[model samples]
Target: MPDHAISGWAVVLGQLAYLLSGTFPDGPLAGAALTLWMAVLGCAGATVLGVGVAVLLDQAPAPLARAIRALLAGLRAIPVLMLIFWAYFLLPMLAGVHVGEVQTVVLALALIGAAYTAQVMEAGFAAIGQGQRNAALALGMTPLQALWLVVLPRTLRAMLPSLGNVWVSLAKDTSLAYIVGVVELSTVATQVNGRSVGYAAQVFAAVALLYFFICVWIESVAALLLAATRSRQRRPLWRYVTLTAFRLARTPARPPPTSASRGSSRSRPAPP
Candidate 1:
């Protein structure tokens, strides 16, 4: 690189501290730290809400289950940007409660994340099916016990990757907070680029790199957790899945009773 280019790059790199901290020492968190905080808070709230709602969807009455499913589908259909807009602009007017920009963004992300998480969890539950729950009940477990001990663990393990992906997506969505002027990483980069008009490419590149690093770190942590969970399980996930498929395949389906068989069984049905 030429000396002038190197000098410009060095000047741009020097703004890294500002991009990360963004008035943190003087004020509250504003840059990458704020983004991460939003993502974490959002994901935590989403996971809790999603799990509760998913369980309710599974166990609720058919009418109520359909309503809950419809609500989730509608929430998922809306864009995250629209959610943010609603939370920021309409929430105060409707609810008469004040919400800071950061809080508003986190709330929007949480709601949307919950919708997706619920969907993933619902699929996981369906995949495991009622057989596991029935087996657990047969072993003297109560309904709640069967859910907690037998069903939730397997479902969560199965859905971990999907959940992690949702979280990663949420982390990326934090960039949208910039639209509300929350001063997250992308916003900070924009500000830096505005000041150094000559180094726009470098500024954006750094921002992308920072986001990439955060997401990769999240994925790595998820992978480690998944590996640890697998080690603790009775069998690896793939083996368990393969064995389950074989069991299901080998189980014979009972034929429907013919008229003669039905008539004979009906006539000879009473035990001595």
Candidate 2:
């Protein structure tokens, strides 16, 4: 039984190696390398663009906010795969410009990610208390200063968990690049399976495991951050208690006025 198990395992490993080597070569640069690079670039570009959009949405006035909301809604309603296909096919004809499949995927992902980010940030901004802004203003800070120094930091803290979730969502969304011929992990896995006909299950299983590992890592980090934030929150409770006590201690005592000072009648004073 052990020997049989070992034989089965060897076959699986051999198949995996054959699929990988056939799909991507062992060199300084290869298909796997390109796929990873594209994924990283796509993810990073999306993040930066998304943050910018969020900032814009947070600062927009009512009318502009409505317009932006409508725009984002439309974008979000469209599927990412459809967006990629449209961009891949129509962009060149419309603008007389062309880009490779990976570039097209990155652009599409960034645009979609930015729309979602803006929405998330809008919620975060709305969640902040007005008293915080008022206090900042009372402290002689300008509107922008209040936003930057007080509102932004707090909003970011509040949004970190959501942002991490969004990032995981984006990572999964990268698999959609396969539709546009961008050789990301999913695409490479598909190619491997195509070449190794009987090993599709194993190939896809391995790919899924890889994605699971990535998500687990992200979640672990998020949990650590949340724990730290909780600790910070506990610390502030003590500070608040101390501050309240100090205010109580500094309150002044007043003396009662004498009966003569209370009298308002000039006639009584003359008689005295």
Candidate 3:
């Protein structure tokens, strides 16, 4: 390659490196580090809250279930940006506490993510069928035991792909944190673009590539986790019992033989 071409490529790489680092050692959190921090913590919070809410929604009384469903629906209806704004402006007043910009974004992301996660989990639970739990009950297991052993394992296994999608989406959505003045990756890229003349396309391309790679990494990890989950062949005692009972229930019953048919079989045997 020509020396000029090599120098141009080096300049592009240097710009990207500057954008990603963004005075990390000298200033407030910014760039790729901030983005990843928010995404990981936000998704973690979402998973825990979402899974818990799903279980509660499944087991709650009729009125409570309706209320929880309505709340989740409302959260889903709101945009992530709006949620961040609310968290940034309204939450402090409501709670009478000082919430940092970073914390606000993380909380907003978590709420929206949890709402989606709950819905996903609800679908997963529905796919599992009530029969699974009933089978556990019939085999002398308590409701909690049945849920923990028989129903949850199957539901999680079935929902693994969807949950992975949710994580990836949440990770991308962390960009919205810029609304709250959190200097994450996108913001740093924009700042770098403004300072560097005639390099907007390259700067933004770097940002896009960063996001692309992050999402790809998340998906790859999720796929590995899913494969591991599926490869697990060991079944707990409760699971084994419930599965056996379930299969037995689904098996078709044989009709009783008529007296004439029985007698015909006896005579036929003697003739043979």
Best by lDDT: 1
Give residue 58's lDDT in candidate 1 (0 to 100): 78
TM-score (all chains, Cα) for each model? 0.83, 0.72, 0.81
* Candidate order (TM-score): 1, 3, 2
Each prediction's RMSD over C-alphas, in Å, is: 11.4, 9.4, 8.7
Model 2 vs. true fold: TM: 0.72
lDDT of 2 by residue, 1-272 (tens): 67755554455566554333334444322233454455456657766877677777667788987887899899999998999999999999999889788788778877887787777777887899789999978866677767766676677678878877876776677778778666666766776667666655566777777677666666676678667765753644554675466556657767887677667544365653
For candidate 3, what is the lDDT?
Answer: 0.84
Which candidate leads in TM-score? 1
- On residues 130-207, what C-alpha lDDT tens digit does candidate 3 reach at each position? 999999899777787688777878888899889889889999998888887888898888787677666666677778
* Superposition error at 115 for model 3 (Å): 0.5
lDDT of all predictions, in order shown?
0.86, 0.70, 0.84
